[model samples]
Target: MDTETLSDHLVELAYGPKELYVDNTYRRILDSRYTEIVGFDFFCALDDAIETALIDWWLSDDAFWGEVKAFEHWQDEVEDGMAWELMDVWETWYGADGHVKIRKASEREKVSYDKAMKKLLCEHEKKKVSIEAEAVRIGL
Candidate 1:
């Protein structure tokens, strides 16, 4: 395949939605824990610093914990983890919102890491070019 097509494929794979299970149901959510230092094209289209900041705020331990606490406080049975129906009806409560928040935060976080990712992509491209040049020089 051509270089650009390969790059696009790699980026799509890297930034694609992930499958996650909550309450025995599968959902597609973007990964948000840490930046994977790949796919600069996706990052270049975003505002990295601001995106990162928002992701940090939304996905922070305190923020998540606070949401959980809110749910628990709002519903006493949450402590026992007995009532998952409340989460299924997230529009009426905090459960689905929590998941959606995390997904958005993860997407923003990926954008935030774009600058560094661009550099990594550049270095990788440089190596690929260098190797190609060496092979050409040797009449490969």
Candidate 2:
């Protein structure tokens, strides 16, 4: 497989849902005689090598950990007080028709609502950026 495809597959095997099962499958594939017969030890080694590199990267990347911390902080903020209420309102509006009274809120109420929504959105975006950065740092 091409390097990008191999890397993508390794990332999925390492980080995807049901990771333990995927890992076991990866190991089994590596140990298969068919792999040896086809001279694919190098390909198998790529996965092992990438896993080691990812571990090393994770251990050495302080910036990645900082991003993780920032993400967690925003995540906590998003779950608290006004931010939490704004998120709930957004979810309610998104998933269903918002209540008529809420939809018809007064201008002053709308301003407060808008401000809270904006704050929540900003925090959410910040959290997402950090998460994507972490993913990139891991070559995922």
Candidate 3:
């Protein structure tokens, strides 16, 4: 099938059952050349596309903020807990010598982590825009 037709079908499947989407894609689009070019099976591609679309939809719709907010809250808690645990281990394992090492390591990690988080958010925003544009382009 053509890209436009496949995209249209995917958009339609986005509004329906995931299993049906996977099954349909597998039966209609899963072939040797397609798999070789895509580097994955039909279900994996469909799943990723559906997930991206769902995330974009959720972020665009105001009502889904509750789930997103909860996820952010959980991430914050986990980050705080990890920091505490690292400090606790550093103090317990090597009292004075580990202090400098821990500080340096923490500083390095903080910089790297900040960069990674920033990059991830930027990528996500870009992906959201791309998905939205693709949907609009296909007149979905």
Candidate 4:
């Protein structure tokens, strides 16, 4: 399928599908690809594109057309790294069932998280630790 068509289907899946269509599509897409480097690269690229689009859509207040333009304001722009960080924060502060009942974190919790992040980041910077190492250290 063309990129636009595939993107549309992905966006539909992202907006809460009736079934696990994305999982089914993932298996099908992987199965259809050839067992070669080029095929592997294509699959990875497509997978990244799908994941990025889904994250963008979920993060946006309105994800029409699967574009990230909604977040590209003059004062703020959600770049890829920032998007990943936001996702990480969401996953950390809010558990898997967070959507069922949205609960704001307490001030103490926020302070604790901020202190932990600051300490971890300082350690990383001081020791020149790789991000992967830091992520491992924090159980990410």
Best by lDDT: 2
Ranking of all predicted structures according to TM-score, beginning with the best and ending with the worst:
2, 3, 4, 1
Task: Tell me model 4's lDDT, rounded to 2 decimals.
Answer: 0.50
lDDT of 1 by residue, 1-140 (tens): 34696466445543522211122132232467853433444434343543454445543347554554554353454323333432333323222454466322355555645544565556656655765564454322
TM-scores for every candidate against the unseen true structure: 0.24, 0.36, 0.30, 0.24
**lDDT tens digits, residue span 1-140, model 2:** 24696467556657633444444543544453554222245445665666677656653477765665666565566446546666586654443444534344667766766776787778777766776675576444
> Candidate 2 — which pairs collide?
none
Tens digits of per-residue lDDT, candidate 3, 1-140, equal: 34696467556666654655544643444566664323235566667777676656743455555544555465566556656655555554343563465333466666666665566566556655665564454333
Better lDDT candidate (1, 4): 4
Error of 1 at 97 (Å): 20
Model 4 lDDT per residue over 1-140, tens place: 25796578567765553233444443433336563223345555666676666656443334332333322331143234444654566656653664577556778878876876676556545443453454344322
* Count of clashing residue pairs in every prediction: 0, 0, 0, 0
RMSD vs true structure, all candidates: 28.6, 11.4, 16.5, 19.5
Say which candidate scores most in TM-score.
2
Location of the lowest summed lDDT over 10 successive residues in candidate 3 = 34-43
Error in Å for residue 104 of model 1:
6.4
Residue 3 displacement (Å), model 4 = 27
lDDT (Cα atoms) of all candidates against the true structure: 0.43, 0.58, 0.55, 0.50
Which regions of candidate 2 fall more than 4 Å away from where they truly are?
1-40, 81-83, 86-140
- Report the C-alpha displacement of residue 79, candidate 1, in angstroms: 49
